[model samples]
Target: MDYRRLEKIKRILQRRQPDLTLITDNVNNFRNLSAIIRSCEAVGTMEVHLVNNQQEKLYLINKVTAGAERWLTQTRHSSIVTGINHLKKRGFTIYATHLGDPEGICCAVRTLDYRKMDYTKPTAFVVGSEKKGISEEALENADYHISIPMMGMTQSLNVSVATAIILFEAQRQREEKGYYQQLRTSQEIYEKTIFEWAYP
Candidate 1:
């Protein structure tokens, strides 16, 4: 590999957020997944978790991702519960998107605006399928609910778009905290990711 390219990859990997990640629940649409992956890469998030139970197998759409899939680390879980538990064990505070009126609903989670919470913490944002929304298991497993405010008649944004919005907000918060200035990842991970990104 070229020295200049390797140095660039090293610089990027140094800022990769080990504390931040994403968990997508049954988001079967390839375009949405691809867009989400692209946004994740743009924001310096290196890891993404997925829970796909439906017929659709997770695959990268190169055109949609613009080749971002090769750079990200994707972890697939058997179910939402498994994914949630795994993150919890890693000391990450998981926030799942819940965009509905909780009135007349049992076990209604307290939803907060995305900006209200501190995104600089070790966190994982969870998004669900477009049609079904988030699963009950995900809601119960998540530490908090995050909602994106909308003014128009439409109550929700597409899953990929929503993920991008939330993640960018996180990036902004981390930037303010100077999270991007130095290496956040451990030595082993930083070296490994740099090697993979450069060689793969």
Candidate 2:
């Protein structure tokens, strides 16, 4: 590990608070889940909600997260519908990202939001499976629906790759606005997570 780069990242993490939450709605592959966990951590997300019932599948995600899964929090849910409602009740503006249209998104988040920062607010984002895309429950419950524009012959990007691209753009925009200027969490959480992330 590059100590300097790690320090730089730690500093950015100290100040950078991205108002993003991830929901895995029936995504079937362990590799994709692990990749998504990697992307989520890289982009500064610490909590992700998983909606899966199978114990075998959840365990498979450990292989993909590369133990970064240990650095973040994961919640299990029986239904995506219930999760969306819960997030909404907490004042999160739930966004469902897909490949269908270019007009609705506001920034370049999991979907784009055109508005400026109220960074202290809570937000939640949902990523769909590779083959089926966003589910109907997410679509019905989300406050906004978004898509990434593609010029290639391919219609959609891989789920993990798409997650990294979208999340980094959100991080990039947040960083410029001095979003990471202050520590957001308790020092205990900060120390514990950083140490676990570095040493584990």
Candidate with best TM-score: 1
In terms of TM-score, how similar is model 1 to the real structure?
0.93
- After superposition on all CA atoms, how large is the RMSD of candidate 1? 2.4
Q: Model 2, range 1-200, lDDT digits (tens) per residue?
A: 57986796578559535356789887777898888888887767778888864454475466677777765688878889988887777778876877764654443435443233233357677889888887888888888776667778898889888777667667776677666677876788777767766775
lDDT, model 1, position 59: 79
* Residue pairs in candidate 1 whose N, alpha carbon or C atoms collide under 3 angstroms: none
Compose the digit string of candidate 1's lDDT tens values, residues 19-77.
88999999999889899999999999888998898754677799999988777789999
- TM-score quality measure for candidate 2: 0.77
TM-score, each model? 0.93, 0.77
Q: What is the C-alpha RMSD of each candidate to the true structure, in Å?
A: 2.4, 5.0
Candidate lDDT scores, in order, read: 0.88, 0.72
Candidate 2 stretches with Cα past 4 Å from truth are 1-18, 53-57, 60-63, 103-121, 186-200
